[model samples]
Target: MVFKRMLQALGVGGPSVDAVLTSPDCRPGGTLEGAVQILGGDHPVDVEYLAIGLLTRVEVESGDSEYHTDQEFHRQRLTGSFRLEPGARHDVPFTFPVPWQTPITEVYGQHLHGMTMGLSTELEVARAVDKSDLDPVAVHPLPAQERILDALLRLGFRFGRADVERGRVYGVEQELPFYQEIEFYPPPPFARGINQLELTFLPTPRRLQVVLELDKRGGLFTEGHDAFGSFDVDYATVDQVDWVAKLDGWLRQAAQRRGLLF
Candidate 1:
């Protein structure tokens, strides 16, 4: 009995945990469902809680260069105060709501390169905890989000890169501490007038606030600077509005209205 207790204390013959996600792909503001499977070894163990954390790897600017950092955006506790006997097996199922402001990891089923996101499971047993399993999660854009992206793509803008900044966008209501910026390289039409464009989306129950930042290229007589514009629209407008034409017009207006203070 002493040897058995020692083995259990060392976790040599204790419980093992595995979490399986129902689907690999999910949309922002959608539900993520999964199950945690636990298997007992040679002895019984008191399981305290089963927790799943949703984490995303983000890039942040530090002085001159950028660094990769991991952030846990959300978590869900599936079970608490459970006991597993020797040779016992149990499955704990859970469903969690993904925040509307969740960052997009993929565009149209294609994983954005260099984007790292996953769901990690932690099993709390007694006074010890173990984080032994991680599963990759794919987050796709919502319908309204896709509409805007499609419009930009059709407007001859190429995706540059995406990053989450620590600050909030000006003139927008946001719940999340950080906001996502999706930068785009300008095409021929706006190349001379603009250096780059940054897009940010703040979603609410009724509408989404779209913020556009235009980085203007400095000419021989002018200094380089940025121009900003924000608009709010309901989901219904996504289908009714000609977003491509509307966005193009906005860019052109920004270019002509140079040096105009926001």
Candidate 2:
């Protein structure tokens, strides 16, 4: 409510808004249900509409420079025009679908070090400044996502960091303006072959599109370069896939040398 006081301070009386989420934890391709509780201030006021948005921090680059900023990825309308009478209280319920590409904010019940996601509510009051509210929201990994993460840990690839960068991965089908990258240091067996590994997941309702980036190390009579690979995995059958074996194959393929324009 500290942020809401700005609107309240401008006038003697104005309607106030508070967003309450009934179900705050969700996965990509799922819906978040919530209610906006509106309270009347000193007089009657007309409200134009109410909406909820999913927001996160993202990095943007411009002319060789990059910076981070808060961005809203998706929005859902809750209510149309309405009137708030003196001391009247109203509840507006909403069910908004989380985007299929929604970034994962938590894994195995632990918050990702640098990732954050939230639900922001906007209330436009006629003839008065609009009021706003925000609540912390968590997007958990889907079944396939969970299994991959668990497998990576089991493979001894320690988590390094994660971030959302502004731009699309070349050759990747994505609806969002950006994508999330999860970085890890290579395990003992692959450490000498690779400097590090970056993993990105482009998930749809039916399956997952995984991209792997390998930073290969330079060796005698050779130069180091990045190698890329992409593949699809079914959500229903992902559990059946031998990820450890599959990932090992990917490591070998990505480490193999390829002819270049050089």
Candidate 3:
């Protein structure tokens, strides 16, 4: 019996946990269904609770510097206190709601470069916490978001990379503290005066807020600068608008006018 207990014990005689997701792909404002599988340790343990959360890498700006860190934005408890007998197994099912402001990690079927999102599972046993490895999750764009992205591609912009920044966007009602920036290289026609363009989407249930930022290229006698613009589209009429033309007009005006502010 002693040898059997020793053989069946988990690392350090503590319980082990594995969180499995039904599907790794989901959209913002959707639900992620999964179950936490727990295998008890060599001895009985009083499990305080089980929790799952959504985490992502966010760029934080400090005084004269910037760094990246994993931030857990939302969490849901799976259970209350329970007794876990030695070598016993427990499976707790959960339906975790994804925040409306969650960042997109994939476009179409391809994962966005420089972007990472995962589900973290933590179990509290007798005041001791055991965290499982992060389970990767893909957040796809909504219909309106997809239209905007496709419009940019149609306008001849090439995708560079994407990342989340730890700050609220000016002039936008934000429920989450972080926002994502999708970077793109300017098309050839506008490449002379503009170096790059960044796009941010702030979506609510009724409308989508789009923010555009352009990095202006410096001329021989002029210094480089940045310009910002924002607009909103009702979700119901997303398909009615001609996004390609709308975006093209804005891009042209931004490139031609050096000091334009919108």
Where is the poorest 10-residue window by lDDT in model 2?
A: 253-262
Candidate 3 Cα outliers beyond 4 Å, as residue runs = 1-11, 127-129, 259-262
Each candidate's TM vs. the true structure? 0.87, 0.89, 0.92
For model 1 the TM-score comes to 0.87
- Candidate 3's TM-score reads 0.92
Please report how far candidate 1 places residue 36 from its true position, in Å.
1.3
Model 3 clash pairs are: none
User: Best to worst by lDDT, what's the order?
Assistant: 3, 2, 1
Q: What is the C-alpha RMSD of each candidate to the true structure, in Å?
A: 3.0, 4.3, 3.3
For residues 162-252, write the lDDT of model 2, one tens digit per residue.
8899999998789999999888998888887787888898998777999988877777898888889888989778878899888877676
The number of the candidate with the highest TM-score is 3
> C-alpha displacement of 231 in model 2, angstroms?
0.7
lDDT of model 3, residue 8: 36
lDDT of 3 by residue, 1-262 (tens): 8764554333367788999999999988889998999998777778888899999999999999999999999999989999999999988888999988899999989989999999999887774445475899999999999999999999899999999999989998788989999999977876877888999988887788999999988878988888888999788998999999999998777656765323
